[model samples]
Target: MTDFRSRCIAPEPLAGLFCAIPHPTGVEICAATGPDFLCLDGEHAPIDRERAEEMIRAAQLHRVPVIMRVPGHLPDSIAGALDSGADGVLVPRVSTADEARAAVAATRYPPVGVRGVGPGRAAGFGYRIPDYLATANSRILLAIQAETPGALENIEEISTVEGVDVIFIGPGDLGVTLGALGPEGRPKLMAAITRITKVSRAAGKAVGMFCASPDEVQGWRELGITFFLIGNDARHLADAAGAAVARAREGF
Candidate 1:
């Protein structure tokens, strides 16, 4: 397993992409391209626990770390992802410190948080349970999204949450909530992004974002984000296929 939690806090930017295609083959394709990590899109895709485990296995074949973007902060969702051997989870729609706390809690096992014990794939099916449980609390990365006005308002408190690792910015959702979409709202959107990054960093947590392209990575990195999910498999396939058809049509 890649030590993805360590990568999240490293000074150099860690670039990643989302694997929303819901298949091990789709995950393997992205893994072959060599992203720093891949986030399984459980929140937006039709990925269920079984599919997620297969996807995790596919990424692990290439030694790529996998983090699931679970549908919610519920313990069941978090536990299922972890049991499948995902390196971490990204909990969406976190709007307060309490929500952030719940996310982290669900990722960890007692004394630290409420995560229950299980002899799943992460533990080598009971064989490595001792070691897996011993280290899981520190090993699993728990990132909570800062996408709503409530999160922006409580950025500091959320950043200060004890076990929260990364404060991931869901730009689209955040913009929608802030009424900050389009060119006219760009400034407002950026301001929110900047503030989240700054505060999270100040509290000693790494900041992450869902970037539209690689071009956006460095600009955000300069502002203190070190983790990024740039684009997704579907977009890549669509763009390449569309361009090929467009070029072919030019000859017609």
Candidate 2:
């Protein structure tokens, strides 16, 4: 009923998946399937601004929230995503407190943040945000990613960066950083995820992680990780496509 990314920021903890591969149809399909949010992949997936805007529009039209995971952790990139009307911005590989601070500052306007305020898609394409300055910071959700070894080592500090709404651990990269990406929930990796949840909760921010399966979600939830990204659109489609072909071959 409520779709963020276009109107409100961090209105709720968006429950959803990231679509690394951008096909409008796939974006539309994810919307119909009904994840609370959909993150447009620009960092790992090849995509353009035009396409990202379209997907954001699509997701909003279908009542699914959209977050854009930008390629860089730079302020300009973050401001652009915010201006593009992203419900939130998931910054990748932010291992330090400064990077986290910069991401927040760039998304909010002066007095709260140094973001340059002007009219754009974020402002209803030049017709919105009548009170953009007064309310933007309260609405914008800032997510800083922890996927590197340095990030894991400094989880407490990273989690405490002011204005950060959530701290998400990149599972694959996180495990690889810890040198154990083979299984889903290795003891060490699970502990790392737990640490993030604990630190973020103590700092008054939400903690989140993306897992390969729903089975993996419950445990993370028990660990106080509320924002659980189940999986991605491309991965699910690919797996289903392969399985369907295999079944047809078997019938043959």
Candidate 3:
């Protein structure tokens, strides 16, 4: 399996795409599209455990690393995704260092964390239990979303959490939280993004964020954000369909 966590921390930047459609075929399609990794959006999407597990398998078949974004920081939410063979878990709505720690703990096993011992597909269904246990602690990535104002205030502390791998910013949510939703609010949003990136980088952590377009990715990359989750499958599909419809109408 690819060590996506290590790649994220590597000298160069890493780019990835998001999959919101809750199906194995969608996972396979995204994997085939070839990003460095894929974030399975279980948080906003209606993806359940069984579908997630199947998607994980689909990703593995295509040799793509997958990180499931759980709805919350609950132990079950985190563990279930890992057990289903996801390479990592992204906990959303993390507003404090404590919540960041809890997210990390949920991804780790005993002693280091309270994560239980049901390995399932991640451990090769008991066949690779020893191998899994020996490396899971270091292998699994734990990313916490830092989108709210409170999270930005505690950004440094959250970044310094021992097991926290990535401090991913939800720009859309952050913009709403900061009351800066349009072009008029670009300055404030950029300032907040810059601050979070600088603090996170200073703490020796990788920074990630959502990029709606290539322009946003370039801007964030300049701010030292290496991990990027670019557009989702649904949006891409809609845009393509809309374009085709417009072209057909013009021809007719």
Candidate maximizing TM-score: 1
lDDT of each: 0.91, 0.78, 0.88
Q: Which ten residues in a row have the lowest lDDT in candidate 1?
A: 3-12
Between 1 and 2, whose TM-score is larger?
Answer: 1
| lDDT score for candidate 1 against the true structure | 0.91
Task: Using lDDT, give the best candidate's number.
Answer: 1
What is the C-alpha lDDT profile of model 2 across 9-90, one tens digit per residue? 2324446888877777788888898787888888889877778877777887887767889998778778877787787888
Segments of candidate 2 deviating more than 4 angstroms: 1-14, 183-185
For candidate 1, the TM-score is 0.97
Candidate order, lDDT descending: 1, 3, 2
Stretch of 10 with least lDDT, candidate 3: 8-17
Backbone clash pairs for candidate 1 read: none
Q: Kindly list the per-residue Cα lDDT of model 3 for residues 1-252, writing each as its tens digit.
A: 567778877635877888998888988988987778899999999999999999888888889999999998789989999999999988999999999888888999989999888648888887898899899999898888888999988887888899998889999999999887899998998899889989999999989989887577887777889899889988888888999999999978
- Model 1 over residues 66-111: C-alpha lDDT tens digits? 9999998789999999999999999999999888888888998998
Off by over 4 Å in 1: none
TM-score of 2: 0.90
